[model samples]
Target chain A: MTWETVIGLETHVELATRTKIFCSCTTEFGSPPNTHCCPVCTGMPGALPVLNRRVLEFAVKAGLALNCSITRHSGFDRKNYFYPDLPKAYQISQLYLPIARNGRVDVRTQAGDKTIRIHELHMEEDAGKLAHDPATGLTRVDCNRCGVPLIEIVTQPDFRTAEEVTAYLEALKETLQYLGVSDCKMQEGSLRCDVNLSVRPAGSGELGTRTEMKNLGSFRAVARAIKYEAARQIQLIEGGGRVVQETRRWDEDRNASLPMRVKENAQDYRYFPEPDIPPIRLSEEYLDALRAAQPELAQAKRARYQREYGLPEYDCRMITSHRALARFFEALVELGVPPKQGANWIMGEVLGALSQRAMEPGDMKLTPPTLARLIALVGEGRLNRNTAVKVFEAVFDRDGDVDAYVRAHGLEQVNDDALVREACAEVLAVNPRSAADYRSGKEKAFGFLVGQVMRELKGRANPQRVNAILKELLMQ
Target chain B: MNITPELVERIADLSRLELGQEEVLETAAQLEQIAACMDILNRLDTRGIQPMSHVFPVENVLREDTVLPSQDRAELLACAPASDGETFLVPRAVE
Candidate 1:
């Protein structure tokens, strides 16, 4: 009996806005306890929330970017709850009419590209943080995060594997970042995911009971949580135990999930339209303008990189994973470096440096002109490949002038054929036994002579020229 | 609407409120009547209409990257019920 895992995600991304969604307080992270709060955000009596105009524009931009249908009329609803993090008791969320719906995002995985259907995206205010004192058993609530703007992007239950889920998340994050809607910083709690997972018998028409995993902060955590939860559910079903629908939290240190609470359905929240704010009506002209503002998304950019730059499928996918890297690649091409060469250096050197530091390519201090110069130098043979690596390392120190650096360090390629020929002849003359071995049909002697010449040239001799001279000397 | 004793107890537990026997019976009847009035929302055909998440059509709210002023620590601490000059003081809370 085969089992299949079904997963959907509700991702919340804190918008990279400056102030709280409804108040004039700063939205900066790590402020003094309750310092960012104001009368409106703190829900003081008689204080009113004025909608931030920038929040709406950002939401519309995100809707257009994700290929969603912007509703001509949408408004806020009150989600009633009694959590201590929300001082207002009832959170102002969109339930009756969301800002956008029916969007689609394409994610590439090992199985191939899959289009994940987006259920909807809505704007809402974030709650505060609860700091629990383990020693004293007291919980303190910090309301600094209250009223911070957030967009909850919900997806349909379309994913089957952990890899596909990660691919979809990566694509979604890249889309949101490229749209300039949110920073999507998983470490800073800017982006978070709640995964709902269930497993059913292969070819079963009915959906199994699913468990929801909350507060998955990292992409890896989300994947691991889904994998563990799916296996747990399948084993329970096989063991003749019922899989209860509940909410679980992923403990990263233990690498396991523990039950948190019973999951609540929509009926539990008792949602009603918010009376504090008015309904939003987006005009057709406004929608058109928003649609026009969206830049080329990941899929379009990846396809264009393949067709326009003649990059391989893998290179195009890697280079276009982040919009910043894609832009850097284009900038290098604009600097007149060949497309293939630009792709190779960025995918190899730039990514190599980033991974070494556990950083993103955009975090690299190396500018486009600096990378372009290094590639051009290697392409033109002014700096040999081995010496170019040294120059690239020097880029971290804010140095430029690849040619000058190589010249000052005497790292120029000894590509002169006569010089290589002389060195190869000297090696053949000294290692007479090897030369004799070559004359007696020992093909290995050819590599011995090539190494000798490269060592004599201090690794600056071109390999192609060394091979040619070694063959020429050995044949003689 | 006839309120069940069992339903009344469940609602009391869920709301995390300790309810007396007489208060529970009255609260259950009131809730059932309210639910009867709210049930009309289930009949509306909402096939194509999107759920509203926010009221105002606002977007792209941003703040400048400049560091701004902050409140004095002593002034902020004045609002706490118990304080030790530098930190908020509370009752012995943990094991």
Candidate 2:
């Protein structure tokens, strides 16, 4: 019998705040253990937690972008648990009044367009890092990552397949990156996802027992776990067994789901309103300012690029896929570079350079102004496309002086009328066979003569000018 | 309100606290007294009065996003019960 799977994702996105949620500790990653910790983050006695303003602003911005209704009055609650990584016995999170609710995003997959409904997005602090010693089996705790702000985006079980789940995740990642809310790097532990999956007989209206799968480090793992768990549940039910509602872990090594523990009920946490931090009340004016300040998202930018700049659909999609690339393209246009020409350079030269050097668009040191100058140099015939590409490669890494590099290399195309005319005259005199063949109307011979003229000028003369001068001299 | 031994044991278990027999009896009495006092406060129901969630009237007390130097690693790690000069070494943990 065919079975259908239902899935919900709880995505925890670490905000790109400069400081921790409750304290002034730096949120920079890869710091030594206990270095980026303070009394508030380490859960010292009598220490009070103060909410970060940027965290609230980012949450509101994310909510608006996701088509969610923002909660004007939101407060924090304590999720009481006894985990070793949790410095405090309870985690400060929002439950009763989350920052946003009832949001939705349109995700596209091979199946079709599906709307994923967002249940709620709440703000909270991250737990500390823990590692177990291989020799001693002792768990080591590092408070450096404690108090890093995160927004847990809980979605409704609107997904029917793993494809939809991954598509939604990719779309969500793009939107979050575009919003500048979070970097959404799965490898960096900045973005973590847990999948809740259940399987039932096809055409069944009743829901089946679901299991929560954790430790999905990547999208591939999420998809794999969903399929494995769904099949596992379906197989159990078909064999006269039952699906247990529990917390399961996605073991990437074993490629299977293992029961972690009995499901931790909400009542187990004993959630109560946090007495330290006050309820955050947002004014309409505050939200208005935030909405007004929202940058153009990928979809809007793609449309604008097509309408305003008349760029090709493929080019618009490629350039606006990343926010930094879009910003750079806009900067280039603002520097008086033609849109299509800039797009070509970015798609061809810039992208080639990035891949060859293993660099991200943002990591490239080549400034827009410098690239525009290179384009201008090519447009003016001072530098041919060939030589300008070399110049780009040279300066793309160090952002070196473009003009100085061009001058030092003597890469300036031969633009002198006299020099090109003389070079054409010599080439014509030397290649009389080709010149005679050209006079006999052999089109390829003409190209041969032009190559000769270019070689005569040491491969620096403009080929168009060389061809023009050669034709003029050949006519004689 | 009746506070049973089972109730005290469950609460202590949730909090990861170990209680002896006499200590459990003593803690049950204290918790019962505290819960009874809260019951007294909960009984006062006035019409048209909003439930108070926080004692402070202020809202949106937040700090700006700025990076400041964290507490010294040596100092902060010193607060731990056992540290090897880098991280806190807890007993072998499960998961």
i-RMS for every candidate (Å) is 6.2, 1.7
TM per prediction: 0.83, 0.90
Error of 2 at A450 (Å): 6.1
Candidate 1 C-alpha lDDT tens digits along A1-476 = 89999999899989988887888788999866777776666566677766677788888888778778887888788887767677676788998789999998888777898899999999999998766566555566566789999999999999889999898888888888888788898999989999999999998888899988987879999988988999899889899999988888898888899998543532377788877777777778877877888888777888898888788899988888787898898898999989998889888888887788788766767788988888777777766787788789887546477667777888888878888888888887889898888889988877877778889888888888888878777777
Best by DockQ: 2
| Candidate 2, A61-121: lDDT as tens digits | 9999999999988899999988778789789999999999999999888888999999999
**Span of 10 residues, lowest total lDDT, candidate 1 chain A:** A261-270
Residue A205 in model 2: lDDT: 92
In candidate 2, stretches whose alpha carbon ends up further than 4 angstroms from where it belongs are A261-267, A416-459, A465-476, B1-4, B21-51
Output the number of the lDDT-best candidate.
2
DockQ of each: 0.16, 0.67
Instruction: Indicate which candidate wins on TM-score.
Output: 2
